[model samples]
Target: MASPAIHIPHGPARSAHLLQRTTAEWRERGEDLLLFAYGSLIWRPEFEYAEALPARVLGYHRALRMRSSVNRGSTHQPGLVLALLPGGSCRGLVYRVPRAIGEEALPQLWAREMPNGVYDPRWLHCDTPSGRLRALAFTLSRRSPNWTGPLHEPELLHIFRHAEGRYGTTLDYLLRTVQGLREHGIRDMELERQAHLAARHGLCAPP
Candidate 1:
């Protein structure tokens, strides 16, 4: 099942102003724009933009399920994966790139982060220090059989335990998320507990 595209209704009147300001800034600077990354990109700067700003987006969720069967790594060494799920929320950083540069950057980022067709890109509204703005985000592909499911800690650990790629292992992805959560002062008990458990079991080591 291909993930269906979502069209978020335009926000309040102020939302239009916010988006216009952001788009104008990018246009003026000739920059590509911002992308909201809640997965490996948070930790692996090399995969995408050079500069990232800590930001959040409302009305979205993040999970660790494969959207497509196009596996990233060798059969013996799988790669870290991300799947968009329903009825939960996510927090992550927003990265900025030059508009011209993003044309080249997005495909590379997608290749590294989304090796399979499991994930698809979409436009989302993000909250930043300045205000609400638009950003590009990746979500589970509607075509994925694994779409819209609950992704618990144990399931995520199982995937990470066997993951290996050019950048690092699945553990690296988990640990970086832990650090990011702390840095942002996010108070999600479930995520905190999961990170601790993954560390205790040696699936991931605390930094």
Candidate 2:
């Protein structure tokens, strides 16, 4: 069988201008950049950070709502990835870039997260054990073409069973995120439910 082709949304990096502008603003203010990681970044940061701590952001919650044709699943049977959507709050990790590379890191971060231009990147206030912080968040608008709104359990199970992308299977993605959250003592009920569904149906092994 031919491998599934990766899906790259058109008009890549639509937020490049905004990211650059925000980076400049932060630089002008001499502020260190804080990168918020809720999904894959939780398990695999692939970046250097001075410190990391559990943090919570208001008015947005994490959902396996974004279609992934590259990192998590292929275009043929698109898998879901974590998306920060409006309403409620999300508990995740926040990383502070080493001061020397704080500014330099924004562009690299943008290239990784903004490739599909699916996220509306913003610096929102994060409440951490150490203190409150202004951390950058990748938010997906419901109106986006990539948004798969409110899929039921069976639909999600099918995706979990079949979806695979350049990186790996969707099951791994969900399991890894669940494990990361458990390790950090962050509870995401929706994600936990999804993992349970996957394991119960033999889509993945139980945690």
lDDT (Cα atoms) of all candidates against the true structure? 0.58, 0.80
For model 1, the stretches where C-alpha displacement exceeds 4 angstroms are: 1-31, 47-51, 67-80, 141-143, 146-148, 151-160, 202-207
| TM-scores for all predictions | 0.67, 0.89
lDDT of 2: 0.80
C-alpha lDDT of candidate 1 relative to the true structure: 0.58
Candidate 2 stretches greater than 4 Å from native: 1-10, 13-15
- lDDT measured at residue 73 in model 2 versus the true structure, 0 to 100: 79
lDDT of 2 by residue, 1-207 (tens): 111222334456455655666677567657666888888888888778888989998899999989987767776888888899989999999998876787667777777666666777777889998898888788887878888999998899889888887778888988998998888887788898989988888867787
lDDT for each residue of candidate 1 in 51-100, tens digit (9 for 90 to 100): 66667766667654552223433446554456444445677778887677
* Lowest lDDT block of 10, candidate 2: 1-10
| Winning candidate number (lDDT) | 2
